[model samples]
Every structure is written in C-alpha cells, then in structure tokens.
Target: MSEPMLDDDALLRYSRQILLKQIDIEGQLRLSRSRVLIVGLGGLGSPVALYLAAAGVGELHLADFDTVDLSNLQRQVMHDSASIGVSKVDSAITRLAALNPQVQLVAHHQALDSDSLAAAVAAVDLVLDCSDNFSTREAVNAACVAARKPLVSGAAIRLEGQLSVFDPRNPDSPCYHCLYGHGSEAELTCSEAGVVGPLVGLVGSLQALEALKLLAGFGEPLVGRLLLIDALGSRFRELRVKRDPACGVCGHAQ
Candidate 1:
C-alpha cells in the first residue's frame, strides 16, 4: 500500500480539492509537498497568497517590505484597517494561516533585490511576480529563469488585467522578458494609473488558478500565451506569445 498521508488535519481541510478528479488524494499529497514564493502582498499577491494557502500548498514564502496602508484595503483582500502600518508579509502570513493552518508561512519583511531575489527563488518550487514595479518584475523574472522555476505573473491597472506563465522548463515557453522586454521606469503604477479594486480581485484570482494548474499539472497553463481582460469594455482576448530567439534569459536555454 502507498505510504499514508501524515497529516489528517490537512487531509480534512483539503477534502474539497482532493475530491476533484484532477486533484485526488494523490494531488493533495503533492500540494502538501510543494513550496511557492510570492514577491508581493498587494493587489495581485493578495488573492494569489490566499488561494494558494487555501489550496494547501505546503509552504508559502511572502516577500514585501511595504506596510499596509489605507489605500491597500481597496484591492488587497488579506488585510484590514487594523493591519495598516504592519509589514505586508507579516499581515499576509497571519491572514493566510488563519485561512489554512496546514500551510507554513515564511515572511520576508524586506524589499526584494538582486541578492534577496536570488536566494528566495532558489528555495521555492515556483515564483509569483505580482509587484507593481517594472524593476521588481524584471528582477523576479531573472531570478526564476536562473532557477528554472515556473513563474505566474499578473498585473492590473485601471480596468485592465493581464496574466501569463513563463515556465523555463518548457523549451518553447516564453519568459516574462520575452513578452514585456526588460524593465522600464515608464511603466505605470497604481499610484499614477489608478486600478479598480475588483479588477485586482479578478486578475489575482486568475493568477491563483494558473499557479494551481502548474502545481497539480492538471491543465494547460498560460505558458506561451497571454490572457488580457479589459473590464472597462467587458472584453477578453488571448494573444499568442513566443520565446524570443534573442531573449537573454530564456533564449539560450531554448
């Protein structure tokens, strides 16, 4: 007989997910053995962290230096007014653990930089880039490429949200760099562009779905394609994306 699962509480908590044909007890077991790293705890990161924890991911590493602010409550579902001034990672851990105690929360209450990104990505099976800055996003992509880990990236501004997966393990898959090019300071931020609160919820939830698909290997992920949702116009579009032959990060590997 197969080795029995070690945690009954985990099994009970994940019963709904385990009931799915695509995620039976075996998949639940796998989820309890995987580690995910999220590089933000804001709009996109909030849902990503919440859903992944609820899904019973064994380990979750949250990296964010910023503290909760009144503005964050608009899109960040994991925090409240009482959490304002507390580090995002810390607040996220408290909320996520309350959601699913089986998940081990690792809080990195520091900003992500070259050194930290290298170390953080090296320890996780997957990385989710939800930071709203180009420099951080590019740094995350580079770190994932270096570690050959699957990355689930998402963004929302105004009424638009976009999501894509960059699995370096796939020879034909496109890295984030392949689609957005390198970092540019001109990229818009919520401070300047203004994002709808629900818009973030929509996009952040999709990021969770993509992350779950990668973890369970149950569905086709958005590895070589991008999903664009324009809530203002109520339009959804899928665009084909390819690995750039000259992409400094993924090109040589491909």
Candidate 2:
C-alpha cells in the first residue's frame, strides 16, 4: 500500500517535530497514521490523551466508564467545571477535538468486557493502560496480549507513580500480569490514599511519550523496564522486569 502524504497544513502543524533529525517527515507521517486506545479518563488518561492528540495520532479510542466530578479538575486536566456530571469519554473528546481536529476520536463510554476489549485492541496499533485499578489493567493487558499489540501502562497513587510497556509480539517482554499477579485486590486509590496532583501528570506524560515512540518507530521504548517516580523525594528509579514463564496471562504454560 502506498503511504499517505501529509498535506501543507499537517506539515506546518507538525513542523517542529519534523525538524528533529530522529523524527523528520517520516516519523511525523508515521505518527499521523497510527491509532491508539486509552483505557481511562482520569488523571493519567488526561495527559495521555492530550499529548497523543496534540502529537497528531490519526485515531484515538478513548474508553472510560465514569462521570467527571469537580474533584477531577485537580489533576484530570482534560475536564473542567463545566464537564462535571458529564461522561469522561465525552469530556475528553471535547478537549481532544479542540486540541487537534485532524485527529479522529472514538469514545467508548462504558466499561468493556472481554469481547469488546479484544475487538478494540485488534483495531488499534497500540493500547495505553491508564486505568486506575489492577482488574482493569489485567483485563487490558490480556486484550493486548491476545491481539499481540504493544501496551503502555501507567499508574499514580499518593506520591508515587510507575510506568511500563509490554509488547506481546516480543517473547522476552514481561506483561503487567508478570509483574503484578491476577486477583490481587490491594485497592490503593488516590482518593483514599491521597495522591499529589502532579504525580499523575508526570506518569501520564511518560506513557504518551512511550506510545509515540512505539508508533513512530523512533527511540528504544520501555519494554522490559519499569520506571518508578517518587514525587515527595523527587527521585526516579528503574527496574528490570522479565517475562514470568509461569505467568497465567502470557506465559507459555498458559
């Protein structure tokens, strides 16, 4: 198939990125044709959605089951006071459309079951696990694994945040299940545990960067490495993660 050409407007809008030696015109065009799925519209999802749209991702599938609350404005920058009581997906689409109308936005306003999730994963080039809890993360990971898509996962709680990428197409890549097993209910929520606002932004932005790298085929992505951030102490840490052969989700034994 012939590659799509970027028009004059697209070239101008993305000229700054195109100027980079690593990106140039080819990388910008790649980004403009890539599709991404982001699960969640809360704190982490806010920046992930914004950055990917601003970067000119061709299509974005946004899935979120919650309604925006006034409290969300603290860190969920995608929504505002007017967005309160509105479905997160709707609110996000409004903001994302304004950010880049050239990018297509699809909103899934309900929680996705296994079948729906798998369908969404199959259609997208990449999946971003911005969900707040483990169950959703595990489900999203499973869908990505089943579809053999790249997964960019990010989480923020209290003063700490972590980000990782898992590509089922890579045999050596460790999935989310490999790091944190299934059926473990730790329930460390931001509301109950009290998260700092900027922590989510920090993690979500990294998730966007990873997704962009994966789609653009640029720098090395964080496939087997987990990045940890300590907001209170202002420190960052990295840990090597390996695929668990016995992992129920992506292990060969499964």
Relative to the true structure, how large is the alpha-carbon lDDT of every model? 0.89, 0.92
Relative to the unseen true structure, what is the Cα RMSD of model 2?
Answer: 1.3
lDDT of predicted model 2 = 0.92
Error of 1 at 236 (Å): 1.0
Error of 1 at 130 (Å): 1.0
Candidate 2 Cα outliers beyond 4 Å, as residue runs: none
Worst 10 residues of 2 by lDDT: 182-191
Best by TM-score: 2
Give the C-alpha miss distance for residue 18 in model 2, angstroms.
0.7
Query: Candidate 1 regions off by >4 Å?
Result: 1-6
User: Alpha-carbon error at 129 in model 1, in Å?
Assistant: 0.5
lDDT of 1 at 194: 97
Q: What lDDT is obtained when candidate 1 is compared to the true structure? A: 0.89
Error in Å for residue 129 of model 2: 0.6
Residue 225 error, candidate 2, Å? 0.6
